[model samples]
Target chain A: MFNQMQLDILKEIGNIGAGNASTALSQLLNKKIEMNVPMVRILSFDEMMELYGSADKKVASIFLQFSGDLTGNMFFVLSVEKASTFIQQLPGLDQCSFVLPPYSEMAISAFQELGNIVASSYLTALSEFLRLSIIPSVPAVSIDMFGAIITYGLIEISKVSDHAIVIDAEIKDPFSKDKNGFIKGHFLLLPDPDSFQKIFSSLGVNQ
Target chain B: MIENGKTIKVGIADMKIAKAPDKLRTAGLGSCVGIILYDLHKKTAGMAHIMLPDSTLARGKTIHMAKYADTAVETLIRKLEEVGVRKVTLRAKIAGGAQMFQTASKSEIMRIGPRNVEAVKKQLEKYRIPIIAEDTGGSNGRTIEFNPENGVLTIRTVNLGIKEI
Candidate 1:
């Protein structure tokens, strides 16, 4: 139900936010990180689950709920392998294992802190761009199934409709030697349905 | 988990029916509840993956019957009846509704998993459908499958592996 101009605005917002997040990641890991152009799409809940792979795909997700002028959910998701790799980069966490539960408290905290730094950077950029006061909740880390984790963000939207508007941004390691170029993670921004109006109005776009 | 029979897949906010030699399944249920209404004697089952507790919460122009607990149970029963399964013979097995994230905020949405489980139970009670088994209220996602042939509900979780309830 959004026009091309509105979609473009959302894409631009993602671009700026993801760029800042990538910068934060680079600083945290002390390596060059690159982000792709963010994609904005309207998808059904089922289709949204398939964005990763399948609903049952295991993922390490850092979730935060933001409130203020614009309310929504933000998820920083990484593949289990990538998450372990990132976790190992933290000092004293070289032996941390994310493959099973009973995960060490140190590893969980390290991952949460990493998520907080990166996600806050994204939120800070968005708030500054829109001139809105957006306060994020404490980052919660859940290494679980993608469908299960993401549906928590969709509860508000699912009340009104089965579809959701998502702003998807990808961050990757530029120097990775993997044949497919390792994708570091994904930032999924899901604004509540009502929040869309606030965002578009803030950008001077009439829906 | 069904090895021999074709499985009827139910998507989020959707429902479907399966008869003997076939199975009903739904994947990735986090805060959502997967309800299975089936008849042991008839060897038929219907599954709904409901996202919300009440249909009254819907603000959209049209309601998706399978998206809410109240409406989904009624719709599932009706569908089962249409397939020649008696309402009196039906039983229920439910799963999912895990608080996927732990947040200190008192926002109702954060506790939706418990709310969903409660609502589904209320609806089933209203219909007088006895709940035979359930695997709910946890912090993990579940993939569930119901085999109508022997009336078994198989639940798979990331941490606990798989169990039949």
Candidate 2:
């Protein structure tokens, strides 16, 4: 349970991280990208799954593990369609045949780099803001059921606590005005239970 | 594949019991075990989606009993008994305890899937419930559907296709 002020502080952290990541993404795609307000929620395992609506939905995700003073997990997730679209538009990938479902080697590496850029941008922002050394592990790419991938991420924190602190930022493609047509992606961070204390203290909070 | 029957969904850290002509389903299980208890005599089934190996690892008082292997096994046994299924007539089948990401396998937490399988097996043995079949311990997520009518558990995965246990 976080106080209003604490929640605001976390939101501010998300804003800074998401802003930096969005800028990097715009450069990557050479297209203007937009981001919505970052939201921080304390959710149970069930609620965490609910955030994605349906667990069976296919998704392409890049996973990263955080090490150092503040341990956590982070990922950048996009729908399979959006991931394909983003990859096909890459400088030299237009001629590559678009495969279905499971991604090809070329696609995997491409997504991994995208994930690295986005996740590192956020981690770098956190490191600067909190003044703590936070190193993220190499990115691992997976294209599978959304629920399965997310469940994999939650296992670490679920061992220590029933609820997880999720900082979620929704990234949108500004060029597409159609709600459904726009490529929607999620940048998520889940700090371990012990790390929360360190994070709050680093932020000058006494929770 | 959608089965033609009343299907009850068991979400993450949840459990459910279904009678014959109905099915119990749980989706997106990764590093989490889906334990199914079947009663041959009464044609009843109970499923629990367990997340952790032990209840002691829980941070707070036992709030979600179904989320742990130890408590969930005991809870499912009780649920089956209440539905007129005798302990002697019960058999178990489990699936899903997958290491979804390979790079994270070096971390102990990433291997929780296999640990969960071991814990569930231990609990089943304690209750004298023999495991009939299982499809677990891979690096992939699974969606399972348990039908009490024929006492079949169908396990579906992204890369491995579908198999019935």
Candidate 3:
């Protein structure tokens, strides 16, 4: 139950956070990265799955849970191909294969670190902007079905409502000329239902 | 007569029924559980993709019956009965309930997979239904399909490929 103004505020928050994350990523890989304006939508569980292509689509996801003034879950999701591409960019991991399990420890760690850097930058920007103390848990990496990984973030929200407020930011690598771009990923922010009040109050906006 | 070779899909917090020559399927079960209540004699089955353990946790105005283990089981059984299937002849097969991400935090929400499995078992016991088979409590996501005609449940995982229970 959010008005247009409230939704705009959340979108702006996503925009700033994603901007910082893309900058961090570009620095790490020495590649030009582009991010679109974040989209804020309240959607049902089924609709949320569809947004990511489908429930069974395989993905590489980095998950983190944040606590403080505004508690919520954050996800950095990439397609299997995109994940491998990013992983290969890391030093000495050019031969890493992320297509199947029994994945090498070095590859996994490299991917995790990549996620860690980008997510930390994103959260840092948000924390500064909102003037809220936010602490993020250690990043956890998983390669699985998109629906399965993403639904983990929905557990807390599902208790309160069937619908969730998803702030989705899409980031892409500009160098690749593929039909869908070279490296594309999504940073999804799902704040717990109770945390909405704290966020609104911090912004001096009535919910 | 049944619709041959058609699969009825059950979405998260949703439910559906299928008859002989037809199947019921649900995809991407992370910490969620999929429960199937079927009657062999009637060649019919009902499936629910449950997201939470109980309806009491619902803070919203309207409760989605298929979203909770307690309510989903009851509602599925009732729906199966409406299709001329006897409650006493009903058997259950369940799957999904995975801890997709490993975290040091021991919050109850983090262990929801096991909790969901337990809640579903409790509901089935309350209804006097015997569990025929189950594939649960792994740290991997599962896509499950149930064939009412042959009473076979098929489970697929990203790492383990596919298996039938």
Best by lDDT: 1
lDDT by residue for model 1 over B59-131, one digit each (tens)? 8999999999999999999999999999999999999999988768778878999999999999999989999
Q: Candidate 3, B112: how far from true, in Å?
A: 0.9
Q: Which scores higher on TM-score, 2 or 3? A: 3
Q: List the residue pairs that clash in candidate 1.
A: none
Task: Tell me how many clashing residue pairs each candidate has.
Answer: 0, 0, 0
Model 2, A133-167: lDDT tens per residue?
Answer: 89988888777777888876787787667778889
Number of the predicted model whose TM-score against the real structure is largest: 1
Q: Which candidate do you rate higher for DockQ, 2 or 3? A: 3
* Candidates sorted on TM-score, descending: 1, 3, 2
Native-to-model Cα distance after best TM-score fit, residue B2 in candidate 3, in Å: 11
Which portions of model 3 show Cα errors greater than 4 Å?
Answer: A177-183, B1-3
Worst window of 10 by summed lDDT in candidate 2 chain B: B56-65
Each candidate structure's TM-score, on Cα atoms with residue i matched to residue i, is 0.96, 0.92, 0.95
Which portions of model 1 miss their true places by more than 4 Å?
A175-183, B1-3
* Candidate 1 chain B: worst-modelled 10 consecutive residues by lDDT: B1-10
Candidate 2: segments with Cα more than 4 A from true spot: A95-99, A175-183, B1-5, B159-161
> What ranking of all candidate models by DockQ puts the best one first?
1, 3, 2
DockQ of 2: 0.63
- Looking at model 1, give its docking quality level: high
Clashing pairs in 3: none
